[model samples]
Target: MGRLGVPPLPNHALATRLADAYRAGTTVVLAAGDVPESLDAAEAIQDAWMASLGTSHAYKLGATIPAVREALNLPRSFYAPVPDDRLFRDGAAVPMAIARQTGVECEYAFRLARDLLPGPDALGEDEIAAAFDAILPAIEIPGTRYGRLAEYGGAALVADAGALGALVVGEPVTGLDPRALGAAPVRLSVDGTTVAEGSGAVMDGGAFGPIHAFVNRARARGRTLRAGEVVVTGSCTGYEVVARGPTIAAHFEALGRSVSLRFAP
Candidate 1:
């Protein structure tokens, strides 16, 4: 039942190539015949790729916004597990080589306090925050090895591990009021010039919708979110692809949490 198209499951050769490209901080432009054509085949390859790397950090969601879903023609949100080396701390710099090739997104993120259980309804804001030990303002650079992005669609992205280029995690918010996150303002800037701005209210039912969607879907696949793993919702401000010289920044109104990353050229 899991086979969607017909390439075969756990494509180890593809997984190895992806793992190598990701660790080298570069992307691969796949050919038409190379793209994963189905969600089942794509996700299976991703699973195998994750196993090949042995890296753990977080899970990221994409296409959470209704407009984005419609635009991408996605049936549901997409998920990818991030590797530790690709994640950065606040105030650091993304190596210029990679920064020049990708874009950045401002997002609301959280770390789980315990394992997550699959559920039917959306978790209330306070209840959702209660399940977490930290709230983070983040910048996600969704990178993909399959370079011609518009051609492949969701299946290709799922195979490329949600196209996660890199992530810059902001300082943790110490006293966030989850109840207020629905209206929390998020901003993204380049060299201190505001490029895009939006609030958490834009997500389906506040920012937690992605997490709930991820949890239910993941559990159905026999996976459960564990403590200490981070979950990043889709971008508040759509991702901005820029050049290598300027500083990229993100800020969230959750107790003034922010992330500032310089690009080293």
Candidate 2:
């Protein structure tokens, strides 16, 4: 038994069950009070989930903004793996049947041009920016294989792969100005009505802050932040639930790039 008398599941069995739930497009709740309590346990579940997915294409940052932390009651930020199969380009059609309860979040994404090697010290914001070759507008669609996300704690959410459904990446923008980018406005709309909006400043450490933090955390876990992998930083606009009938779009005002997804009934 672990914290709160929640017995930990064997890594392989937990991963297999999670993967099955995802593939079957069904919800699977843990036993009452069975959530993992430590980051290590949560991360082990995360690793198992990622391994089950096979290929890792991108990373998603969670609780990067104060609002998110407050809403989820998390003390700090966390990272989750985004598998390649869940990534889609702009204007992709998302099947609502696959993701029953979907929400959208506007975000900034960066793709590294060079490998970020692990070191004793954490990478600074400027160094993190320099490592990226391009910046892009992104919209993250979050879904859960649970009945209600609020019922689960932060560690449980982490083990559930951050509730990430799919990432819609827009066209890459080059020659970005850091200062200007950090102040950029982002908006999310459902069926032409704007539901949520904010700026890069909404993130606790600014636009590049999450990237810096993710790298350091990964390195600390004996993992390397590889090149050619996309990093979807924290959302500028908070998560807004989108109904099945509407078209959802996220616009990056300064970058002049937008990504849209339509849910098919």
Candidate 3:
């Protein structure tokens, strides 16, 4: 039984399906019995998958914007612990032979200087400010293992590891005020043509906002954001659904950095 005597989530079966789909790089359409009906159940399934995967390499946050949350029927942002296998450097050609569709979004990716473990009391401003090492321009290629991806709501996304497919990072920009990043303008280009434009302010205040939220939330669950780990906050520009044959680029102009990847089918 769960905390309130509800039967515990059948995380094992679902996690196995998630893990198998990860290994096979294929889609999974969950049956009613395997589908998670609640956010708690979805989180349990994600944790189970992570446990089976052995270790996590990075964290990805999504659906941070209030409007986006409303569209997904989510009360808050979602996060996923991604494996290193999908963390690609800029200029890498991502093989998309099996993918039917993929979406790209741009954002700030922060590499932590030290662990951000919760203290006995509330975290102060200095503690939050000191947790950063550098910021990088990032474009996330978020995907799903399930069919009719949009029909599934936030809980389904949380279960599918925030729909994280791959993350491509550009050069890190340091020595800049992390708080000021919220005002930075970001542009997304496809095949050298602009497709989307926005600023970091859309990311729930800034790049660090989601980090702050995730820290407190994880700490409550007895987890810590360890040193040297990367936390990628949600999109600045919304997203582009790339069907095939396009080079996507994200430009974080204020920081003078950009990153890009090509989809090769």
Q: lDDT per model, in order?
A: 0.74, 0.77, 0.76
Arrange candidates by lDDT, descending: 2, 3, 1
What would the per-residue lDDT of candidate 3 be over residues 1-265, giving only the tens digit for each residue?
1122224556677788888887787878866666677767787788777656656657898778888888888778868877777788898787874344568888888888887664434565557767887888888887788875655777878888878688888888889767777577899998889888998887687767777777666665556678877788888888778655678889988889889888887
Off by over 4 Å in 3: 1-9, 97-100, 118-122
Minimal lDDT window, size 10, model 2: 1-10
Put down candidate 1 lDDT per residue, 47-138, tens digits, no spaces.
77776666666888887888877876667777877778778888877885555365778888888888865434445545656777778888
Candidate 1, poorest ten consecutive residues by summed lDDT: 1-10
Residue 141 in model 1: shift from native, Å? 1.2
Residue-by-residue lDDT tens digits, candidate 2, 61-94:
8888877778776777888878787888888888
Clashing pairs in 1: 28-145, 143-163, 143-165
RMSD of 2: 4.3
| Model 3, C-alpha of 109: deviation from truth (Å) | 0.3
